[model samples]
Target chain A: MIANILDGIVLGLQFGLLAAGLTLVYGLGGVLNLAYGQMAVISAIVITLALSAGVPVLLAVALGLFVGGLAGLILDLTILRPVYRLRGEPRVLLSLLLTLGVSFIIDGFLNWRYPLETLSLRIPGEAVEILGVPMRRGSLIASAITLVTFAALFGFFRYTSLGRAVRSVIQDQEGARLVGIYPHRMLRLILVLSGVLAGLVAVTRSMVTPVDAQSGLSITVFALIVTVVGGLGNVAGALLAGIILGIVSVIAANLIGTYISLIILLAAAALTILIRPAGLLGVKE
Target chain B: MLKVKSLSAGYQGNDVVHQVDFEVGSGEAVMIIGSNGAGKTTLFRAMCGLLVPSSGQVFFEGTDISGAPAERIARLGLRFVAAERHLFPQMTVHENLLLGANPYRPDPKTMSLILDLFPRLAERRRQHAGTMSGGEQQMLAVGRALMSKPRLLVLDEPSTGLAPLLAQAAYEALGALRKQGLTVLVAEQQVPLAMSFSERGYVLENGYIKLQGTAQELAANPIVRRAYLGVT
Candidate 1:
């Protein structure tokens, strides 16, 4: 049970990071990026290709992360241009449809080109013992990276002026404008940041299990579940919900079975909605 | 410092403020007085670039700023504080104030001035803006706008939700800022408070400027007294 919980923590940290990216974009600009998972898959594929071309591991990962951010920037400069012209429900609907289309196109292209490509970052080390349970070095390293990323993210949002401007847009677009912060510029920046986060999740997840061309849908689904269970646009809520759901999924899989654990996770998310519709830490609208 | 020429604006295709011509010279305290739904808000919104004007031009410091986006206008040093005070509710008072100087570092001297102007804001610097009382929120709203050291501070119904005493107190703060030589253009429904604070005034009725004169002139005008001042 201790080992399972530890493993769940490892997974939960990734889940939290994934949801943070999705939530920020939705909160900042009402843009629901359905192609988010495809971004991660593309990053993973980029890293795999770079590695096969004999690039150093670190450089390959960096290249992947850059590509991820570039993907977001491209999205903003292209399809999201029309989406920004809209307001309220129409904006959300149009963004969803457009990003869904983008996702399908990306998924199809990846399947056709790299059908067997996968990313598996092997951290060569013996299993480390923690609390009398043996943990894989890759898992430990991945969790460390995730924790550090979260800390940096929190610090950026809390301490930096640029980060505050981003938060201001999320809180109130008009208020942000009154302060001379352009909503569109902030949205573009966040989309890029979200892409980098997606890439980071793909990299970390690959350290635990291989991430392949077909992993995009599952990634997006997991992110959506964590995002909803956390709150649509609340970062801290995402972290909390991610960990709780992570543990529930692991424990359920241990006690019942792996296939049923996904359903169990969905049930937990549903229960959270029924009980606190605003999410665990979401502000009541 | 600001000029509007034949400005007409409204929601959709309907013009709520029609042919509204007004100007505020440097260091002047100007007021646009009107009752609720009399197009005061619409006029201010159009001038500040929050709404696109159907036909007209707005000149700030002799440069045309008509139909510009709100953020661009703000960066040009004309900040608008809406009646609803669109503050970041989840953020602390300090964060909200800091954002008012966004894209630029918060100047220490200006920060000190604002805090001194509103001691209550200093006291609640760490408190979330949404949790503050209506009066304190009003102070924060004005203080936040002041952080940018704007050339012209355009305010819309600053006294909207405040108690009678608090409303007067808000004008008192604005009065103090005016004494500091800051240019101000305010829209107020509370005619007496505004009349006392502003040197020049314009009366907006329906969608047009009905009267423009000195405060004393408007205060003594029989029509103004009968319609707004509640004096027999």
Candidate 2:
């Protein structure tokens, strides 16, 4: 049970990080990026291709991150241009449809080209013992990377002027404008940041399990679940919800079965929605 | 410092403020006074680039700023404080003030000046803006705008939600700023408070400028006293 809980925590940290990227875009720009998972999968594929070409591991990962950021920048500059002209419900709907279309195109292209490609990073080491339970070095390292990223994100948002401007857009767009902070510019910046985060998640996840061309949909689904439970735009809420749902999924799989756990996770999210519609930490809009 | 030529603006295709013409010279405290529904808000919104004008141009410091986006206009040193305040509710008072100086570092001198102007804001430095009382929020709205060290401050209905005493206090702060040579253009429904604060005034009636004169002239005008001042 301790091992399952520990493993769940490891999984939850990734879930939180994934949700943070999705939530910020939605909150700041009202753009629901359905292609978010595709961004991650592409990054993983890039890393895989670079490794096959004999590039150093670190350089390959860096290249993957760059591509991921480029993907986000492209989305913002291209399809989202029309989406930004809209307001309120129409904006949300248009963004959803356009990004979904983009996601399909990416998924189809990747599946056709790299049908058998997958990213699986092998961290060579013995299982490290913690609290009398043996934990894989890969899991330990992934968790460490995720924690550091979260800390960096928190510090950036809390301490930096640029980070505050981003938050100001999310909080009150007109207020941000009154202060000379352009909402569109902030949205573009967040898209790039979110892309980098997507790449990081793919890299970290590959250490635990292989990330493949077909992984996009499931990744988006997991991110959506965590995002809803955490509150749409609230970062801290995402982290908390991610951990809770992670433990619930692991414990359910341990008790019942792996297939049943997915249903249990959905049920848990449904229950959370019924009780707190805005999400665990979301303020009523 | 500011000029409007035949400005007409409104929602959708309908013009709410029509052919409005006014100007404020450097360091002048100008007031646009009107009762409810007199199009004061619409005029200010159009001039500040929050609402696009259907016809006419707005010149700030001799440069045409009509149809410019609000952020761009703000960066050029004309800041608008809307009646709604539009503050970041989840952020602390300090964060709100910090953002008012965006794309530039918050000046220590400006920060100290604002805190001195609104002691209530200094007291609630760490409190979330949404949690503050209406009066405190008003101070914060003005304080946040002032943090930018704007060359001209445009405010819409600053006294909208405040109590009678608080309304007086809000104007008092503006009065103090004007004494410091800050250029201000304010839209006010509370005519008497505005009359005392502004040197020059324009009476806007149904989207048009009905009268333009110095404060004493408007205060003594029979129509102004009857319609706005509530004097028999």
Candidate 3:
């Protein structure tokens, strides 16, 4: 049980990395970021394509991340910005519908262009033992990289000029405008960061699972569940809640395998809703 | 200096402020007073570049800044402190204070000067602005506007929700700013005891200036007495 718990810590860290960016998008802008899963998919595809192109592996990964960010900017400019120009719930509802259309479009285009087998990358075979734990070298490495990156992002948001501008826009639009901080600039930043985060997830996913054209919506469900179950507008809270939920499932898997994991997921989600409808760390009105 | 000529503005083209004309020279104070639906706020919003006029122009500092973006207009040393907006409720009070100085970020010396100007804010500098009393937050809002070191300060209604003493204090602060050569334009329902604090004020009703004169001149008018001063 103790060993399994330790293993679960590593797993929890992975999910935290994957979900943190999505959570921040939701927290800062109140957008569900429906296309976030595509970030991971595209990152993986870019890495795979670079390898096929004879590019260096590290360069391929960096390019993959860049691809994700570019995709975020494109989505912001093309899809999200138009909807954002509208007012209130309609803005949210329209983006949800439009991004859903975009998901289908992206999936179809990827399917048409790349055969499913070409995109899959099996784990670079290696085991690394650390802190008395044996873990997949890729998972450990990605997890470590993610933890450090998120820490830096957290620090930036907590103590930087631009981050404060973004936070001001999120906290109160009029107040930000009162100080002459343009919400439009913050909106653009949101889109770019969304791409960066999505790309991070995509890179890690390519290493672990085969990404089919149909894979976009599958992981989105999990990210949504993580975001909502954590909180609607609190990134740090989403992390805590995501990791907690991650541990719950991992423990269930080690103790009872897949059967009990679903039960645990359902039960924990229900309890979370019953206890804190605003998620664990959502700002109260 | 700010000037509006034939300024006509409204929500959705309904024409609330009808061909209004006004000007505030440097180191001058102006006020607009009106009852509900008189379009006073709309005129203020329009003059400050928040609302675009339908068929008119606004020139600030002798530049045709009509239809300029609100943020850009703010950057040009004309700042508007809106009524009843509390932007960052969840952050610490210090955080809100720092944001006021953002556009002027290159000048930390201005920030200290701003703090010195509003000593009450400096004392509670570390407190969360949201938790502050209505009066304190209003002061913070105005102080934040001062961070930009605006040549012209436009306040919608500094007296709303404040006690008489607090309102007087707020007006006194405006007086001090005006004393230091900052142009001020205030819109309020209650006439200050002396408009001595302000050089001039205009009374608006039904989207036009019902009365305009030196602050004391308007204050002494029979119409002004009935409309605002409640003099029998």
Candidate 4:
């Protein structure tokens, strides 16, 4: 039981970094960006390609950040901005379809170029003792990175000018715009930020499992589940939700099996949807 | 300091206002009176760049800001306050007021000036704006807009959801703002109160201006009385 809990804590912290930003973006924008998952996929692909091309690992990571930021900009220009302009439920539907289509397109291209390969990253996945519990070194590093980034982001939104602007946009778009915050610019920046975060998570994942086209959709499913379960737009809430869900899944995989864990999480999400449409922390609008 | 000529705008792909000509000089208070659905909000929106005008000109301080984005317009010291939807609820009153000054990078002293103008707000600085009384919220809304230190302040229904006395107090504040050399264009449904405070007024019915006169003339117009004020 202890080991199962430890495993959950490890995985939860790692995944929560990606999930928190997703919650904020979805809450503010009011659109589930189906393309969000592939941001991670692209990051992994970029890092791999760069590293394979003899670039230093550090440079390759920077290259991943650049690629992720670029993808985010592209998503904003091609998907989110237009969706915002469309101005109705149609906008939500359009964004959903558009993002799904984008993810598929990216997956198709990656599959065509690379074909089927066990695309995994090799790092020292050594074991370490943490607070008297044994943990994987990769998971420990990923958790630390996630926590550090979240702490930084927390500081930013709480104290900075741009952070307030983002909060204003999230709380009230028109008011934010009225205060001279260009929504398009903020959205672009937020999209980039969200994308970069997902990219970072993918980097952590690369240190664990082999990634492929399938992982894109797979990760998206879990991320969306965690986001909604936490509460649609609450970042801290989403992190908590991610951790809870992560633990559940980890335990289920250890006990019942993988597919059953996925099933249970989906079932709970559906039940939560029926009871509280906004999730745990989202405001009822 | 503000000008709109041949300004026509509406919701996407349709025109609610047509070829409207109006101007508000520096330190002037222009009241826009209209029945509901008569295009007052649309005009205000277009002028402020919230809604893009189909065709027309908007000049501020002699700069052609006709098709600039609303945020850009706001950054240049023209701010619009949609009275009902004004306050950022979750934020503290102080935070909400500070947000009004957001378009500017950050001016420490401007905040004190705004809080000084609305001492009631200062007293309730840490309180959540959403939980504030309607009167206080409206004050916060106005106070927030002033935080930008706007030369031209555009207000939509400043009297909305206010008791007569509260509205009067709100108008008194608006009156004081004009006294301080700020240009104001107010869109109001309350004609008698509006006419009393404003120097010049425009009467709009169904998206077109039907009358332009000094407040006294508008108040005395039989048609305006019969149609708008319900005065027999």
lDDT of 3 by residue, B1-232 (tens): 7888998899996999898888898888888777667887788777666777787888888888887767778778888887774448766656776787667673678677767767888888778777888888888888878777888889888887899998888888888777788888888877654355667878788888767888779878998887678888
Q: Per-prediction DockQ, in order?
A: 0.92, 0.92, 0.59, 0.62
Q: Report the error of model 1 at residue A54, Å.
A: 0.2
Better of 2 and 3 by lDDT: 2
Error of 4 at B122 (Å): 1.9
lDDT by residue for model 4 (A1-285), tens: 878887887777765776775776776776678877788888888888887789998888888878887888888886666788775578778889989999999888888886553336565755888667877777777777778888888888767878877878888888887778887677778888888888887877776677765678877887888887878667777777778877888899989988798898898789779988878776766
Candidate 1 lDDT over B129-232, as tens digits, reads 99999999999999999998999999999998899999998999999999999999999989999999999999999998999999999999999999999988
lDDT of 1 at B40: 90
- Estimated TM-score for each candidate: 0.99, 0.99, 0.91, 0.91
Deviation from native of the Cα of residue A252 in model 4, angstroms: 2.8
lDDT tens readout by residue for model 4, B94-171: 777667887665576877776777789989999988889988988888888888888888999888889999999889
Span of ten consecutive residues with least summed lDDT in model 1 chain B: B41-50
DockQ of 4: 0.62
Deviating ranges (above 4 Å) for candidate 4: A78-84, A115-126, B12-15, B224-232
DockQ, prediction 3: 0.59
| Candidate 1 pairs with clashing backbones | none
RMSD of each predicted structure: 0.9, 1.0, 2.7, 2.6
Model 2, A1-285: lDDT tens digits are 899999899999989988989998998999999999999999999999999999999999999999999999999999999999999999999999999999999999999999899999989989999989999999899989988988898899999999999999999998898889999999999999999999998999999999999999988889888988998778888899989988889898889899998898788788879999879998876
Q: What's the lDDT for candidate 3?
A: 0.75
**What DockQ does candidate 1 score?**
0.92
lDDT of 4: 0.81
